[model samples]
Target chain A: MKLAYYPGCVSRSTGKEMDVSTRIVCAALGIALQELEDWNCCGATHVPSELVSVGLAARNLAQTDLPIMTSCSICYSNLRSAALTMEDPQVRAKVNAVLTKKYSGAQIRHALDVILEVLEKNDELITVPLKDLKVAPYYGCLLTRPRGGIDQPEFPTILEKLIKTLAAEPLDFRLKTFCCGGPIFMPQEQAAEDIAFLILKEAKKAGAEVIVTVCPLCHLMLDAKQKALEQRYGEKIGIPVLYVTQLVGIALGLNPDELGLEMNAVSPMPVVEKVYEKMAEEA
Target chain B: MAADEEFKQEVLRLAGPEVLTCIQCGTCSASCPTAHLMKPSIRRLVKHCLEGKKEEALRNETIWLCTSCQLCTVRCPRGIRPKAVVTALKELAEREKIKGKDQAYEELFQRQIKDYGRIAEILLSGEFMFVFPQGALQSMELGLEMAPKGKIKLAVEKIRGRDEVRRIMEELGKG
Candidate 1:
């Protein structure tokens, strides 16, 4: 019922819309999200050293004992890896040394895992099913990769299952667990663009009307960078990248405005309108 | 010469012995989405680390280019963590003052967090523009687009627990 929610930096700032939708969906599903008190950024891709990065993660972990739920893939990956690293006696000592609060063991759960569990338990929560919406579940690398990830790394289908539960079609995209060029977005802008272009191109080619993602960075790459990518390749890639929460919220019959659909750089309204049209026709 | 040896030991110490298990299988390189952008590739970086060529590995753009996606880590047959190896090299580069382009952004990131405890996107871009003027012109298109969308914040709002975060970071400095 209740979990410590760690929205991380992007979710608070650039990815605030995703966070908004996450809250709305969770409330609708009866999952109480208690924001971690005094939580800091999870040292995304910018920390100077492993020790400092892990220490920052540990500091956040030390704040709460409840299973930490993170929406950002970078935060999930970093927090999980830090918790795993603290298993080492040396790492534990080093991490413990650098903190006012010491982290012994913290279970990091991706927010998707939390929602998936809720959906599995109760399938009737889907009041407004997206029967005709075809969505590609883009996991990106961090959500389901690394050691002790939530699902199978190479071929994750948990999001696909969730999509099906919402009565939407989930495409078997080849790059489901692919990297979104998030880490290099700032420094190597062009490289990041090229990678984003490839992901958007592939998702479009796969007949994905909407590419749903859980990670803010991945969403930024696929959605916010679509215009730049289109200009670079001299082609149209109008596919809308959506947060999983936003899609789930739509299926749950929540208001589109509350879901932060407007916050998306490429408006998801076209896909949303199509879904609405299909639902009305069925009615 | 001894300094180079010292850097090698530091890398091994931070990254651990698992990095030494790399068999040059190229699974990491092949799996890496961004390996094409780098010269030596992640596999070669590990090889360089194993050979104790600390300077070469640290100086390579590959170290900074890693996105920490862990795709290579997941695909590596030998259970080696190529991402951690890159992190170690990045730390080594920071220590040795080799100064990769990524390091500049990393420094800016750290400074922003230390000062405000949270990143104010608008301020961050403004500061980034001042620091990397060439990039400012290039990224301006993206920045201009994000401003009206409510994605970029115009003001810096410090987190509620700045003192606590400062204390934790101070402890790290003492290390």
Candidate 2:
């Protein structure tokens, strides 16, 4: 299987590990991720706000003849929203008119939808049983919103299905679809931190050893900020945030480093160590 | 003053005709993760929109802080759609370039969206250093610590669809 992949800004920056692991795991599963050449950003949550047409126009033009895939939840949302809008006759005509007047045509796809489709096709790649692993799958805001598409808007089951396929137990957490305080981190650090704290706190309470996500922004806000949150809240909420690709890599028996597990602020080693121990005991 | 009134009405009108039914239940605020951090509640902001206070709403820092989480809409009894409301206000702000103090952050955020179809850790770290020279040292230390052992080669090498992805981004920019 092959996908035209779009690794958004976060994956290139602090979330490079996700990009690394995603490629490793995809290769192991015989899935090819073709990184989109000269791919522009999806405008995330902002472009869609300022100029919906321009934002969508930018993304729509970025898509080539192939279906585009992205790793960030925000990108997924923005890209998917653009694709949806473009498919509409009036919207498409208007957008295309704008595009023809502006530049050449471009097309893209929602990354999560593509990844989910790939997983569905190759369900057997999850050879390593993850029965002992209890994970909290977070679907942050973007993947499921604006009232449309493949995944449920309110509560999504795609990630849950993916986790179960890996043989891991998916914890039921209230904040699974909640915001990870992403775009707000800079302007409202306190609020972003508070939201992050709440999500981590709830995940911990629900017994999630690791919180898995598809969006790099969510991963950074939720996982990287734990220490600061602990300092402010005087509580040690240490649930590790794992990109969905990392978990898939582990299930394929790839090494932790290959999955970029080291980059997480809350170290995932303890959970990995426990998994290895369980494997040894079972052996 | 009429133009200002017209802009306010336009904002409310673009909000999809549901602006006036806001019951002030605070469900949107309660559900919003960012709301807990905002000085004025998201609920209050929606009320401001309903009241035709366009300038005040656009100037608020909270307008830019939303993550577009639909929790508020999901929880709203009156279907106020606080997230969408904030988004509309942000559009207005961007039009006037009335960026809050964190405008640079917003720009950096947009740059990330524009560069890679998704966010890349290495690139984001580099951007952090470029934007804030003081952050370079800290970013480097963090990068070294988070560097994926043995996987550095894979990242540096081009994957299959890279060229096409780049072309697509260029098209978007030109478009």
- CA lDDT of every candidate: 0.81, 0.67
Q: Lowest summed lDDT over 10 consecutive residues: which window, candidate 2 chain A?
A: A98-107
lDDT of 2: 0.67
Q: Write the per-residue lDDT of candidate 2 for residues A1-118, one digit (tens) a residue.
A: 6677777655655677788887787678676777766555556665534334344435445555555666766766666556655655654554454342232444454544555567
Candidate 2 per-residue lDDT, tens place, B31-86, comes to 76666557578888887777777766777767766777777776778776677687
Per residue, candidate 1 scores C-alpha lDDT tens digits across B59-160 of 777877788888888888887878878887776677668764578888788877787777666676677776667667546776666667777766777787
TM-score of chain A of 1: 0.96
Which stretches in model 2 have alpha-carbon errors above 4 Å? Answer: A48-62, A88-90, A98-124, B1-4, B17-26, B74-81, B95-99, B107-175
Q: Which residue pairs in candidate 1 collide?
A: none
Using all chains and alpha carbons, the TM-scores for the candidates as numbered come to: 0.95, 0.80
